[model samples]
Target: MAGCDVKNNPTYLLVVAGAISDGAGRWLMHRRPLAKAHGGLWEFPGGKVEVFEKPTEALVRELYEELDIEIDPAAVEPVSFAQHDAVDDEPGIVILLYRVGEFAGTPRAVEGEGIGWFTVAEIDGLERPPLDVELAAKLGRLFPE
Candidate 1:
């Protein structure tokens, strides 16, 4: 065990995010709370997948918790993913991005962060994490004009 120091290394996380789109083509974005990691950056609405929970299950749970909305698991379709490397002491994360086309209730920022709808072009200018930036690019390819 020459190089086995698990305690010194950050753990990996499985993060599930939704590219929640209105029927008209704009997608939802959530601003990270100032007290959280990646604070002040825009990200797709999602959160970490808990143990024993599937990715889609996590998406539904997270959306409700963060946005105060209900997402039907069947309404979410896997679209793309981003594998982010750990930086500094941060944990590496594999983000699974889903396209949520149908959901109930309005998206309110229950976590004291900003929420907004943006077109693909508008998303290009937002301050987002690298994983979100990649997810946005994939969205552009999926719904090109």
Candidate 2:
């Protein structure tokens, strides 16, 4: 059906995610709510970049909304990115991963999602979403075992 032709009417989403690490080398991870996309899967903390908002701006807002943390945009350092094609009927997504070098306030799950701090050795064991899996690999290289 022409209406089902995603190639002709593709939708692109810009999603921003953060890897907030403690100085001791542990990262904060968020588990997607069971009712949300990739339900029950673990991921970096962040959300969709709204129109008219920069990715860093969106990330700062998302961290506050999802984790109750206030992060300075200047503290976010671009680390990696992933481009995923459309799956099933869903639109394609481009996810940008940033390292949160500094933030004020402790992280707490404010959006009903599970939260945990994981070390590089512990990351491989977590059931992370696809995008997060890629980001983790890159992160692992930065802090080899």
Candidate 3:
């Protein structure tokens, strides 16, 4: 273990994201708040997966906390995933995006700057975090025009 630089030993983070659709061709994205990392960037709504928590469970909780919406865990399905390399002091992050077609309550940005529904084409043009950029591209592939 000697000479093993802890800083260089990238700490990978597990994050869960949701691709919520409004029963249309539009998908929901959340604008991060100005004070947080990747601030003001639009991303699939999600958050870190806590210890012992499954990715889907984390997504369900995150959506509720961030958008004031309740989603069924059983209804969630995998869509795509994106990874961001560690830069400087930040840890590397791997985000798992899930798609949820049904939910209770209207979505409103409870923690972020805002929330909106956009087509995959429109999402590709929006500013997003590095990992989110990858996720958007994958979405375009999944639901092509």
Candidate 4:
């Protein structure tokens, strides 16, 4: 119901929660555990939504469940979005990126293998999943230079 987001195409809404702590602006990312698909891939702290939940609601729940933070709700905003259609013999995914500068509590890996804060420059240095690699670029456009 917002922008040109397609409701189809194996679509996924990737919510990104970012902030600055310790005088450094770092984006929060988490690694998937071994039991899931794309396991071990570093992702922007979120998961898929059930049919009954809104994207924003899903984000708030995910943050509390996965990161132990309380989102302001009023501060979360969409920054950029991308559709990933892999070439050749691979699966395609669409990700909707988001941004926020504020939240409650410290960020820890509450639901996965690891959690870390990465500067925008360091984000590109990590070993990321296929379409997830574009997250930084999308976020850049969202927050601007």
Candidate 5:
């Protein structure tokens, strides 16, 4: 991983979660593990998308895999998109954010970490993933309550 640059490119799946529950507009967010980069900071739960997978399709899989919740792809609405500058020698990613206005099941950190739900306004208060915060700002514009 030395001498390799990962920026302004695609090597990760940038995802945003509108963790709505029972019709409320809160979102699900998590704290990155200490061993990971940006550790201890809050971030919406999601990760890199595999090649040849649609964003919606990939999101469903990721949510299930990482968060242990099943997401209906059709329930996902594209609210915004963003491209992030890479950090820590990591590849830049195209983060596509969608509003999951309707979904089924509860969200839990199936992977390994702390997780929670916050209202749109509360997002900025949390120390969030640098890239995810960008998407959250865009989401604010599309969903003004």
Candidate 6:
């Protein structure tokens, strides 16, 4: 709801997600806390873009808050994006996914059930939110080897 309208009516939301890769064919993913939406499912670490923040800035803040890491905005590369239209009372959301190969500090699950590194194949086998499923597919396309 960070980018929601004042009236709280359905509004388009801009979300940012990062694919933090270890450069060894593995990427970091976080497991949602059991009480949260999509609980127990793994997804990229990120959050909504605040009203006054750029997507990269939002991603930096979100990564620090959720993963205990510091990322240089310049080091992030746009890889892919996935979006869903507004439906009923649900707000439409667009997730911009970035490839983050460099960062400071180890990633910890500061606000989730846990964190793990997985290859694209392994990630494809894990339980994930619908949008994450789409994002992962697009991520796989980034490396066509």
Q: Give all candidate RMSDs, comma-separated.
A: 2.4, 3.2, 2.6, 5.3, 4.5, 3.5
Per-model TM values vs. the true structure? 0.89, 0.89, 0.90, 0.76, 0.78, 0.91
Which ranges in model 6 have alpha carbons more than 4 Å from their true place? 1-10
lDDT of 1 by residue, 1-145 (tens): 6786755553678999999988787999999999887898999989999878999899999999999999899878899999977778788899999999989999999984789999999999999988899999999999864
Off by over 4 Å in 2: 1-10
Query: For this target, which candidate reaches the highest lDDT against the unseen true structure?
Result: 6
lDDT of 2 by residue, 50-107 (tens): 8789999999999999999999998788988987898786888999999997899989
Off by over 4 Å in 1: 1-11
**Model 5: residues >4 Å from true position, as ranges?**
1-22, 86-89
lDDT minimum window of 10 residues, candidate 6: 1-10
The window of 10 residues in a row where model 1 has the poorest summed lDDT is 1-10
Q: Of the candidates numbered 3 and 4, which has the greater lDDT value? A: 3
Write the residue-wise lDDT of candidate 5 on 57-136 in tens digits: 87788788767777789877777777876668585667777766665677777765788877779887988776778877
- CA lDDT of 108 in candidate 4? 81
RMSD of 2: 3.2
lDDT of 4 by residue, 5-93 (tens): 35543344444333323235677778888698788878787666656677777778878888888886577777655566655644455
Q: Could you give candidate 6's per-residue lDDT for residues 27-81 as a string of tens digits?
A: 9999988998899999999999988899999999999999999999999999999
Candidate 1 global lDDT: 0.90
Q: Choose the strongest candidate by TM-score.
A: 6
